[model samples]
Target: MPREVTSFSNALVKQARGLRDKKNRKREGLFLAEGLRILTEARETGVLPQTLFFSDASHRLLKELIDEVEAAGGEAIETSADILHKISGKDNPQTVLGMFPAFDTALDAIDRASAPLWIVAQSLRDPGNIGTILRTGDAVGAGGLILVDDSADPFSVEAVRASMGALFTQKIAQARWEDFVAWLRSGPGQLVGTSLKASADYQDARYEKPAFILVGNEQAGLPAAYEAECDLLVKMPMLGRADSLNAAVATAVMAYEVINQWRRR
Candidate 1:
C-alpha cells in the first residue's frame, strides 16, 4: 500500500515542489516530472523516479508504475488533486508526479562513436528550446544533446513538460565551450556549426558521420570565437524577413541534414 499525503505542507511534497526552481533542484539533486505518459516513458527507458505522487483518481491509471516503483524500493504516495496541483505549480496538473534524481551530465560520460549525430547548443536560455532540442535529437537518432555554457536547465518542470517525454529518451550533457572543443578534438568527430554569417549553404555541406551540430545563443547567435572553432560553418537560407531560425528549429534542420547524409553513404 502506498502512503497517503493530503497536506501541501508535507515535507516530501514541499521538497518535490521546490524542484520547480533551479536553485532548489540543484540543492536537492532532484527534479520534478509530471504526467503519466512521461513517467511511463521514463520507466520504459529503465529509469525510475525516486519518489512518485499520484491522485486517488489516477491510482488505477498508474498502478503498473506504482508497482514497479515499489518493487524498486521507491516511495509511492497517494495524494489529492489539490496537493498534486501544489506540487506541479499548475491549476490543472497531471495526476501523476515524479521526483527523479538529476542525470550525470559530465562530458566524459559520452562516447563519440556511439551515434552518427549529436546536437550541441551554446548559451541557450529557453527551457522550451532545450526541451524541443531534446525531442529533435531523439527524432533524428542523435546520441544526445550537449549543452554548452550557461544553457537553460533541461531538468526544469517547463523543460520536462516541453520535451513530451523525450527528456528521458535523450542523453544530456553540460560543459563549457572550451572544454567541449577540447573533448571533440580528442575524438573522431566533425564539429559543424550553424551561423548567420556563414557563406556556405547548409544543404551544400557534406555532413560526415558522428557529426556534432552546434548552434548558438538565440539572440546573439554563436560567438566569433566559438564559430572559429567549428570545422565547418554552414548557413540556413532565410527566405523571409527573419534573419535566422529559432535555435531548436535550426538544430533540427541541421540534424536531419546530417542524418540524411549518413543514410546516403
Candidate 2:
C-alpha cells in the first residue's frame, strides 16, 4: 500500500520543494520531473524515480507508474494538491510529479559503432534552448549532450518541460571548458564549431562519422580561441537583417545536416 502525505511540512515534501533550487538539487542528487510523458519515459527507460507523488485525482491515472515505482524498490505517496503545487513550483502543478536521480554520462561512454554525434553547448544560458537541443538530439539519434563551462542546468524545470520527455531518453555530460577541450582532442570525432566569422556555409561542411557539433552561447557566439580549435568551422547564412539564429534552431539545423550526411554514407 502507498503512503499518504497531507502536510507540506513533511520532510519528503519539503525536500521535494527544495529541488526548485539548483544547489539543493545538486546536494540531494535528485530533481523533480513533472507530467505523464516524462514519467512514462523514465519508466520505459528504467530511470525510475526514488519517490513518486500523485494527488487523489491522479491516483487512478498514474497507477501503472506508481506500480512500477514500487516494483523498482521506490516509494509512492498520495499527496494533497497544495503539496503537489509546492513541489512543482507552479500555481497549478501537474497532478503527478517524480523525484528522480540526476544522471551524467562520462565522456568515454560513447559507442563508436553507433557513429555517434554529440552536441556540445559552451557557456549556454537558456534552459529552454538546452531542452530543445536535448529533444533535437534524441530526434536525430545523437550520442549525447556535452554541456561545457557554465552551461544552463539541463535538469531545470524549464528545460525538462521544454524537452517533453526527451530529458529522460538523452544522456547528458557536464565539464569545464579546458577539460572538455582536452577530452575532445583525445576523443575520436571531428570537432565542428558554428561561427558567424567562418566563410564556409554550414552545408559545405562535411559531418563525418562520429562528429561533435559545438554551438556557442546565445549572445557571445563561440570564442575565437575555441572556434580555432574545431576541425572545421561552418556558418549558417543570414540573408535577412538578422545576424544569427536562436541557439536551439542553429543546433537543430546542424544536427539534421549531420544526420543526413551519416545516412548518405
Candidate 3:
C-alpha cells in the first residue's frame, strides 16, 4: 500500500513543487507530467517516472498507475487535493502527477534507417508553440526535434500539457546554432530551411532523403548567417494579409510534404 501524505510541507511534495521552476528542474534533473493520458504514455514509451503523486479522490481511480509504479520500484504517495493543485500550478489539477527525469538524445543517436526527417527549431520563445510543434512532429513521423540555443524549456508545464503525450515518444536534443550546423555538416541529411527571402516555393523544393527542416523563431525567422548553412531554402505562399504561419503549422506542412515526396518515391 502506498503511504498517505496530508501535510503541505512534506519533503517530497516540496521537491515536486519546486520543479515548477526551470532552475529547480535543472538542479534536480527532473520534470513533472500530469493527467492520466500523459502518464500512461510515459510508461508505454518506457520513460517511467521515479515518483508518483495522487490525491485522495484519485487514489482508487489511479490504482493501476500506482501499482505499475510500485512494481517498477518507484514510490507513490497519496496527498490532498490542495497539494496536488499547488504542485500542478493549476486551478483544477488532475488527480495524478509524476516526477520524471529530464532526458536527452545525442545528435548522432538519431536513427537514419527510416530516412529520418528532423525538425530544428531555433530560439523559440513560446511553450505552447513548442508543444504544438512537438505533437505535430510526432504526427508527421519526424525522427526527432532539436532545440537551438535559448529555445523555450520543453519540459515546462505548459509545454508538456500542450504536447498531449507526444513529449514521451519524441527524441529531443539541444545545441547552439554553430554547433548544430557543424554537426549537420558531418551528418547524412540534407538541410532545408524556410525563409521569406527565398524565391523557391516550399512545394517546389526537392526534399531529398534524410532531410532536416529548419524553422526560425516566431517573429524574426532564421538569421542570415544560419540561413547560409541550409542546403536549400524555400518560401511558403502567403496569399492573405499575414506574412507567416504559426511555427507549429509551418513545420507540419513542411514535414508532411517531405514525407509525401518520400512515400511517392
Candidate 4:
C-alpha cells in the first residue's frame, strides 16, 4: 500500500483540482489526464505520470497499465474512490488521474518547413470544441494546434474526454494571438481564416506553403485583429439554412481540406 490519500482536503487533491485553472496549470507546468486509456497512451508516448490515483475497484482493470508505468520509472498510487472524486472532474469519475510533464511548445518548431497546418482557437471557450479540434489537428498531421486568449484548458477532464486521448499525442502550440501571429509571419505559410463569406470557397482556396487555418468561436467568428492578419478568409459552401457548425467540425473540414489539396498537388 503506497500511502493512501483518502481525505478530500489532501494537498495533492487540492493541487490536482487546481489544474482546472490555466494559470495554475501554467505555473506547475503539469496537467491532469484521466481514465486508464489516456494513462496508458501517456506512458506509450514516453510521458510518464508523476502520480497516479486509482480507485481500488479499478486496480485490477488497470494493473497492466500500472506495471507499465512503474517499469517506465513512474509512480502509481492506489487510492480510494472517495479521494478519487475529490480530484476528479468527471460526472462519473473514472478509475484514475495521472499527472504528466508539460513541455514547452517552441514557436520556432512551427515554421513553414514543418508542413505547418495550424488550428488556432480564437477565444473559443468550449473544452469539447477545443478537444475535438486537437483530435482533428493530430489526425491531419498538422504542424500544431494553438489555443489563444483564455481558451479552454485541453488538460481538463472534459476536454481530455472529448479529445479521446488525442491530447497526449498532439503537438499543441498555445499562446496569445499577437505572439502567435508575430511568429507566424516569421514562418513560411499563408494565413487562412474561416469565414461564412469569401471570394473563394474552401474547396477552391489554394493551400500553398505553410498553411494556417484559423477557427473562431461558434457564436462569433475570428476577432478583427486576426481577420486583419489573415491572407485569405474562406468558407465551406452550405446550401442548407443552418448558419454554422461546431467549432471543431468547421476546423476539421478546413484542415483536411488543406491536406486534401496538398496531397492532390
Candidate 3, poorest ten consecutive residues by summed lDDT: 55-64
Q: What is the lDDT of residue 76 in candidate 3?
A: 89
lDDT of 2 by residue, 106-157 (tens): 6656454464788999989999999999999999998678888898898888
Predictions ranked by lDDT, top down?
1, 3, 2, 4
Q: Model 1, 149-221: lDDT tens per residue?
A: 9989999998999898899988899998889889999978889998777899988898887889988899999
RMSD of each: 1.2, 1.7, 1.7, 2.6
3 or 4, which is superior by TM-score?
3
Task: Give the TM-score comparing model 4 with the true structure, all chains together.
Answer: 0.87
TM-score of 1: 0.97
Off by over 4 Å in 1: 57-61
Q: Which segments of model 3 are wrong by more than 4 Å?
A: 56-61, 112-115
Q: Write one digit per residue (lDDT tens) for candidate 3, span 49-158.
A: 88999875344447777888889999989888899999998999998899999986566665654547888999999988888988988888887788987989999998
Deviation (Å) of 243 in candidate 3:
0.9
Q: Model 2, 51: alpha-carbon shift in Å?
A: 0.3
